[model samples]
Target: MNTADMKSRHTGGSLRTGLPSTAFMLAATAYFLLPLWWLAVAASKSAGDLTTTPSLWFSDVHLAQNLQELWTRDDHIYVRWLLNSLLYAGGGAALGTLLAAMTGYALAKYDFPGRQAAFSVILASVLVPVTALTLPVFLMMSQLDLTDTYLAVLLPSLVSPFGVYLARIYSEASVPDELLEAARLDGAGEFRIFLTVSIRLIMPGLITIFLFQFAGIWNNFFLPLIMLSDQKLYPVTLGLNLWNSQVIHDPVLRTTVITGSAVSILPLVIAFLLLQRHWRSGLAAGSLKG
Candidate 1:
């Protein structure tokens, strides 16, 4: 074919491929964003107006009133639930991420007896669905008389096999044996090397782990439901579920539930926005190593 004809054909093929990808991206973006848009619009309406108005458009602007009621109702129980979620997600993620990073690093870098067995066990744990373990966990908690406590939720949240797996993969790719040997030659203790040299290098991986664990804990419902019977101990997920059940009988609570859900998503949004950079950087580091 002539150069001009070939160029035209290549350009046409590129257009055909790119157009579908662009369209798919736009469709996916809209699909994910639609719920958020609906929540934002719904949060602004009063209970009476929420059902009557278009879900995508505002009717009565009662955002302020709804927020006021949300804050003031039941002596600000929503605030308490928010605090509980923060405690569970923040503490659990921090502890879980640290432990996962440490375990993964050890698995990736060290030689010890039963190391392969331990790693195999961890991988097995990942395959076990969390729901199946809930009853056994609850029974253990009952035996310990630890049910209805923050530890009941937070403790379990800290044991994330998936985080450990991710951290292991990241550590194998991002951390080099030469660096560890260098640190060792400099006479740094194993723990000191981990704290100063290795931890900083693997920080992006740790942050990714933390964000995953945080989101998991924040959205956790069934575990907490099975563990705690006291309403005061409820996380926002369970608390919101309770409110939703009551919304059927009390129509006024419909707006409250919608507004609460909108508000509930804020922390997750903030977390993603803050940690996305680390996640991207971690992926880049892994890719570069590969």
Candidate 2:
């Protein structure tokens, strides 16, 4: 074939091959976004209007009414639940990420005895599902008289084995021994070296760990269900689940639940958006090293 014809044929073949992948991605995006779109539309409607209106389109906008009701219902219990969720997710994730960074740094950099054994234990813990541990954790918390308290939720969330594993891998790659040695030669303490050199290098990994733990704690249900009996102590997830249960009897709560769900997702979305840069950078660093 002539060069012009050959080039044209090759371009056409490439376009044909790319089209399916492009279409598939678009379809998948739509599928995932469909629920959120529905929730946004539903949140804008009253309980009566929800069934009557089109699922994806707004009608008789009652978003302000919903917010007022959401706040006034049970004397602003939803607000309390939101605060509880923030405390559990935010505080727990912060502490957990720090612990993970320290533990991972130790595991990666230190040549202590039983290092391999300790890591093996962490790996085993990671393999054990959170659901499996819920009962034991509840029993332990009961013995400690911690059940139904914020600590019951926060304490358990502060130890993420997977976060530790990821941090260790990232620390091993991102933090250099030479830097530690130089810091030590300059009379820096181990903690100082870590804070100044290693920690800065692993900031992206720490942010990833924080975001992961935050989302996990925010969405956690079973553990809190088993631990907390006090309605006031409940996070947004558990509170919403309770609302969902009551919706069968009280149809008006259906709209409240939907609105609450829509509202609950906003903080998580904002969190991801804020921290996504760090997450992306961390993944890139991991890939480059790997």
Candidate 3:
């Protein structure tokens, strides 16, 4: 065959090979997006329209009315839930990321006694299921008399072994030993060096860690379900579940629940949009070395 003919054949074969993978990707996308689309459509519907009208499409836009009901119901309890979720996720992620970075930096940079052992323990801890530790954690909280308080949830949320692992890998990949040595020679304290130099270098990784922890804490249902009894202290997930449970008796709450679920997703979407650039860079850098 002529050169052009040969090239065309190769291109045809490549396209054929990519078809299945492309199909799989499209299927996966639809699988995930369909639920979100349904939620948006459902939330926009009035209670009567929700059951009577088509599910995947919109009818009358009752979103504003539903949202107003959600906000004003029970003296505006949904707003409290939103604030509580923000506090739990935002504060927990930030503090957890900081602790993870410090621990990871020490592991990557310092050659301390039992460093390997400590890292091994952390790795092992990551493999332990969160569900497996729930009872023990509850007991610990009981011992400290912290259950039903914000601390009960916040304390556990602040520890992320996966975050530490990611931080250590990113530290090793991004932060140079020579940079640390140079900073030390210039008389910068260790903590100061970490704050000024190391933090900037590994920021993308920290963002990744923060995002992961934030999502985990935000979606956390069991922790708050077990820890909190007071409705005022409940996170959005627990609060929504409470509303859902009462939906059978109070049919009006059905619309409120759907609307609240739709609203609950907004914070996470906003967070991802805000940090996605840094988070993508972090993933790329971390994957390059580890």
Candidate 4:
């Protein structure tokens, strides 16, 4: 059969009306993009223009000035918040990924006593809501004199039960037992085998774990909110919330808050786009192996 005829037959000779699919796709696009579009418009307007102008389009084109105000206003605390977010998220994600990878590799490739029990505990911890632990964590930090310190936030952020789970699954699929056995026969230590073989094979899964943890730590608010009393220690999420709350009294801050919100989303977008290739490859490899 001809290709066109076969396709038609496979489709049951239905009328070629793609209108529903097209409309659904357009609706989905608008649903996601409309808020972003409004934010762009809102960010560009000054105090008066925001109220006077239409929300979907540009008015005074004062986004540059608004960004300047965001930086210079309020003791330039916005800049400090941005830096603190980067430090907390970046450092936490990196350390968390490393520890998760090591733990997962050991769990997957090694035979030891209490291994299953240890993994069961880690998995159980994953089921516990972080919000449930916040008060307890804060109390412990207070007793240890760690509250209000950077360690209070970064230390807890480093633990990722989900990341370890993903790493274990990926390690089992990607790193074959024969390879480790051969490496051992060649006089390579367990750490050397993990470093040289297992790590390279599991790179995609590691990237996925890093992205998840990065987004989590970057957008974390509750931990920082309760653990930190000083404004200097607040992450961007908490700082922006503070700015948003005061908008009721000083409505002029509305513009500044919108501008900060717009700027804060850029790092996350860039990070995801940069690592998206690895993420796709990792998920694809996992699914295919399964």
Candidate 5:
């Protein structure tokens, strides 16, 4: 074919490929964002206005009023619930990431007795339904007098088999064996090598693991419902459920529910923005291999 015809064919192929992918991306973005946009709009409306006004457009813009009402209600219990959620998600993610990273690193870098068995068990745990395990966990906590305590909910949130799996995959792919050997030649301890080299290389994957665990713990309901009876210890999910159930008697609470729901999602959004930078990092790991 002539050069001009060849260029024309290539242009056509690029257009055909890029157009569908771009359209799909736009559609997926809208699919995820539409509900959040509605929540923000609905939260701005009054109780009566929420139902009467358009679903995706602002009505009274009473967001500040709604926040104040939500705060002042029942001696600022909503604030307590928000704090509880932060603690559960943040603490769980931090602890879970560290443990998962270490376990995964060990599995990837070392060959020990029962190593395969350990990974197999962790993979099996990922397949098990978290809801199904909630009852047994609750029973165990009850026997240990841990039920209705912060530890009951927080402890379970700290264990994430999926995080371990992801960690192992990232560790093996990103942290070269040669780098570890180089560090060992310099007399760096195993823990020190992991801290300085492997961890730095696999940070993006660790951020992913942390985000997964954080979202899981933040949105977790069944485990908290089964484990906790104390309202003071309730995370945002359970606390919001209590508020939602109360809407039958006090109608004004509808706005609070919507507003609180909108507010509750802000932390996750902020966390994603903060952690997204790490996702682009560690591309230089292979280049730095000794």
Candidate 6:
């Protein structure tokens, strides 16, 4: 074939190959975004408009009014729920990430007798569903008189087998044995080396772990529902769900619930956007430096 005809045929073949994948990705994106779009539209409407108006289109804008009522109703209890969510998600993620980093580092670097066994246990634990373990965790917390308190939720969140797994993977991939030996030769203690050297190199992985744990804890429903009987101690997920259930008796709460759901996701979105750069730079910092 002539060069022009060959190039035209190649381009046509490429387009044909790309079309299905592109269509699938577009479908997937729309699937995820449609709910969010509906939420935004619903949150902007007044209580009366929620049922009256089209579900995906904005009606008379009562977003500001709805937000005001949401925060002010029941003596501003929604604010309390929001704060509780922030505390639980933020504290749990930070502490969980730290513990995961430390444990993962030890598992990856240390030559302890039971290291492999311990790692195996952690990996196996990851396969066990969280729902399956929830009852046992509740029983344990009840025995300790810690159920209905923040500790019931926070303590369990801190032990993330998945986070530990990610940390260990990153530590092994990023940290070099020679670097540890060099640091030791420089008279740096193990803890100091870990804090200064290993932590910096594995920061991307840690950030990933933190974001995952944060979102998980923020969205956690069943655990908090079982653990916290007091409304004051309830996270946003449980609190919103409580409000949602009450919408049958108090239809006005439907708009409020929708508004609350829209607001609750803001933190997760902001966090991912803020740390996205670090996420993208994973392994590069360690690979270059080590």
Candidate 4 achieves a global lDDT of: 0.92
lDDT of 1 by residue, 1-290 (tens): 89999999999999999999999999999999999999999999987777777989988799999999999978999999999999999999999999999999999889999999999999999999999999999999999999999999999899999888878888787779999999899999999998998888788878878988999999999999999988888999999899999977988988888899999999999999988888888767756654
TM-score of each: 0.95, 0.97, 0.98, 0.92, 0.90, 0.96
| Best of the candidates, TM-score | 3
Q: Model 6 off-target regions past 4 Å?
A: 283-290
Model 5 residue 117 distance off true place after TM-score fit, in angstroms: 1.7
**Which sections of candidate 2 miss by over 4 Å?**
none
Model 2 Cα displacement at 197 (Å)?
A: 1.2
> Residue 245 CA error for candidate 1 (Å)?
1.1
Worst 10 residues of 4 by lDDT: 10-19
lDDT of 6 by residue, 115-164 (tens): 99999999999999998889999999999999999899999999999889
lDDT of 6 at 73: 89
lDDT for model 6, on a 0 to 1 scale?
0.93
Prediction 2 global C-alpha lDDT: 0.93
Please provide, for model 3 over 1-290, each residue's C-alpha lDDT reduced to its tens digit, 9 standing for 90 to 100. Answer: 89999999999999999999999999999999999999999999999998999999999999999989999999999999999999999999999999999999999999999999999999999999897888899999999999999999999999999999999998898899999999999999999999999999999999999999999999999999888999999999999999999989999899999999999999999999998999898888888979
Best to worst by TM-score, what's the order?
3, 2, 6, 1, 4, 5
lDDT of 3 at 92: 100
Q: Number of backbone collisions per candidate, in order?
A: 0, 0, 0, 0, 0, 0
Kindly provide the TM-score of model 6 when superposed on the true structure, using C-alpha atoms.
0.96
Q: Which should have the higher lDDT, number 5 or number 6? A: 6
lDDT head-to-head 3 vs 4, winner? 3
